[model samples]
Target chain A: MNAIEIKGLQKNYGDFKLGPIDLTLPEGCIMGLIGENGAGKSTTIKAMLDMITAGGSIRLLGKDARESSALLKQDLGIVPDEIGLPEGLNIRQVEKIMADSFRNWDSKQFYDYMKRFNLPEKKAFKTFSKGMKMKLGIAIALSHKAKLLILDEPTSGLDPLVRDEIVGILNDFTREESHSILISSHIVSDLEKICDYIAFLHKGKLMLCDEKDRLLERYGLLQTTPEILRDLDASAVLGKRVTDYGAEAIVARDKVPQSFEIQPVSIEELFIIMAKEA
Target chain B: MKGLLKKEWYAFLQKPVTFLFPLALFVVLAIQTKSQVILMYLPLYFGILPVTLMSADEVSHWERYMHGLPYSRSAIVSEKYVTVLILSVFSMLVSGVLLFFFMNTGFAVPQFLFLIAAAFAASVLLPSVMLPLNLRFGAAKARIALGVIFAIFGCLAALSVDDEGGSRFQLLEKLAGLNISIGALTGILFAAAAVIMAASWCIALMLYRKKQF
Candidate 1:
């Protein structure tokens, strides 16, 4: 079963418009939503979670998102950009609240995550550092026995060490074939480490969505002279930067001549080039 | 619903002073002035407790976060009403006990019962107006609207008073002269307040469903 299926989804904000966006994330796969600030990433996630009214259809866990019944939500673990718990609550208080909130909330798992994350049970949430707060949010999401996780900018503000730790934890969650995740981030490197598939959102439109491996295999960074770059077919060069030393362009692997040397392109480099081209 | 209630309770406890200080002041004033009217304000105070909670939710953005949880919009709206009801009951119990002790000190049984019932009704009636406003325009703007409403009522109340220590006594004399029993009046007030509260819940739920988080 697909974890999420969005078809012709759209939202209008008077000045800016989003979508007619179509996206799919199969069960057991981690799909990374890569976008810059104000690119409608949060807007799309809000629509999928039924937090906002938008046009078109969205199915999550094989159920219509607009229905948004409590039963359906029980299987969804969500970490919004801000961890929205009452700041005055201590970890223990939060655990108690969650236990009552989710029917399948596992206290042992929650506490275990707390210990692993080194979050203090007695410390109020307002006193925790940004990293600790994020870890707690992730712990709550993971302990609820949810089949699908929707994370929005979960790693944006954290340090590299914390981001890596969160990425590793998310990777662990998807070990079970029934578990799936759709994480959005402007921090492309973190998503590159864990996401099986990547979707690029530019402004309010979806620029590209494909398997990470297939994307890397299809695009290459070609470093050659400007004279040679000028001769290259327009279809071959997706985006290019030229200087006195050389010309660097993201080129379609198959479209480029085999005689030219092509280097592997990182996801971050690919996104930057694509966004610049757009 | 339980989870939401628990969170509210925890938040309430976080800064006990905010709730406790007013309660303490009321108790001290009641004792110092030897006035039953001072204690009567307790129910009104409790009735508006949910507004403070709603304000806190806005500050923490919990209102936005809650939409992602496994709760229906109605459940979210119902939780606030439930909290208000619970606080109202607590206020009644506190006032009832205090009034019970004052019964021997010039307060008659019928008068005491009427006061307690009035307090409960007032407790219910105030939130009945405020919660729907809070749900529709949010706590901050709703607060200004509530202040305007209270000011209008205050002016009307002031206008009703006359010389010779005011028309309040004249109104009381008129009420006492009526054939209606205190018990019947109390029952009517209770029922009316409850009906208004139920209607308010429906309005709040409708407004909350339309809210865009």
Candidate 2:
């Protein structure tokens, strides 16, 4: 069985709908779930943890998510989109709390992360800056020897240096292929660096789920004339951007016509073309 | 779940509201109602301590953070229940002494047991009513709903207070000639009410477990 499988996950809130989402994350890989602000990233994560009212079949580590939440959460450590640390707690307090809560929490690992991040042991969380808070969130996430670290926008508010540091830590932490991560972020470049698989969600729907290299290699930014795109194959065309200079067709890069030149698109530009349905 | 409970207690001490409101009301009520020593202080005796603790927690959105910890929903829920149970026992001990000093009516023994039991009954009721609501609408909305429910309950209690009549109270007249010791029966009723309070807490937990937070 896959490390994570979500099938027909349905959750509705009046006009807001979460799914009919179907996805799978094979073991021993990082899967980046890319989406915009309101594109149901957090909702899907919540549903996966059985933290919200949801109807679906979800298997994380070969157990039903709802029936086996108590056991499943042992392997799963979730750091939400927002760091929900207690305002009164210091870094030390957080370590104590996490240690007491998670049976597998590694106290030495927690303090090491805190030291690496330069998070103060005595300062209350409320006194920490936004970046420090996110660091604290990261520290807690890494402390538990978790098999699956489900991080939502873990580095959204940090500086590039801190972001690099955190990314380096995550890369090192997952040294044993036994650990996997399903991280969601709007920062596609960050995801590009770590994630082996990529899933794009747009307006509560799954746009595509594929390998990072395949997605990058497959999608091409053809910046030739609009007339050129009109004469080319339309079936494989995922999206287009029209500008005064020319038009850009998000065509399969490997499949581009011999007549026109192709340019590489970064993950962000690729998402801009392919992830948006409208 | 010890993490959640420790955090709850740590956070509680940092805020003045948790102890201040209960202490203020307990003292004020101790001075009211010709000093029944236990019944008039019923608001404090019944639910004040737990209410303060739970309300403080509600204000902090601690449950959301607690969910980040590796704890079963049932364990988290039971911690809240048990916290209230512990606080109720503490409240009876603290307030029972205060009652003795205030009434000077030899209430140390019987009233201690009665107040402890009744206070627990009251403490349990607030969470029993508020927990599911908190799960559905969160702390802010649940606080408003709880305010309204308790206000309505307070009004009903006030309206039922005795008028000048041959009987000490209207409720007393209604139960006249019954061989039951009203005080003893009330203690029994409160105990039964406490059981329902605990049961409702379980139901709220089950509901909250599936609720989107």
TM-score for chain B of all predictions: 0.87, 0.71
Give a tens-digit lDDT track for model 1, residues A1-278.
99999999999999989988999999999999999999999999989877778999999999999886577889999998899789899999999999999999999999999999999899888999988988998999999899999999999889999999999999999999999999999999999999999999999999999999999999999998889988999999988877889989999999988998899999999999888888
Model number with the top TM-score: 1
Candidate 2: tens digits of C-alpha lDDT, residues A1-278: 47889999888888888778898988778999998988888888888887887878988877888887877887887887667676777777777777778888899888887778888899888898877887788778777878888888888877898788778877886788788889999888888899889988888877888998888788777887888888777776788887899988788865666666777777788788876525
lDDT measured at residue A97 in model 1 versus the true structure, 0 to 100: 91
Cα lDDT, model 2, residue B34? 35
Question: Number of clashes in model 1?
Answer: 0
RMSD of each: 2.6, 3.3
**Which DockQ-derived CAPRI band holds candidate 1?**
medium
Give the C-alpha interface root-mean-square deviation per candidate. 1.0, 1.9
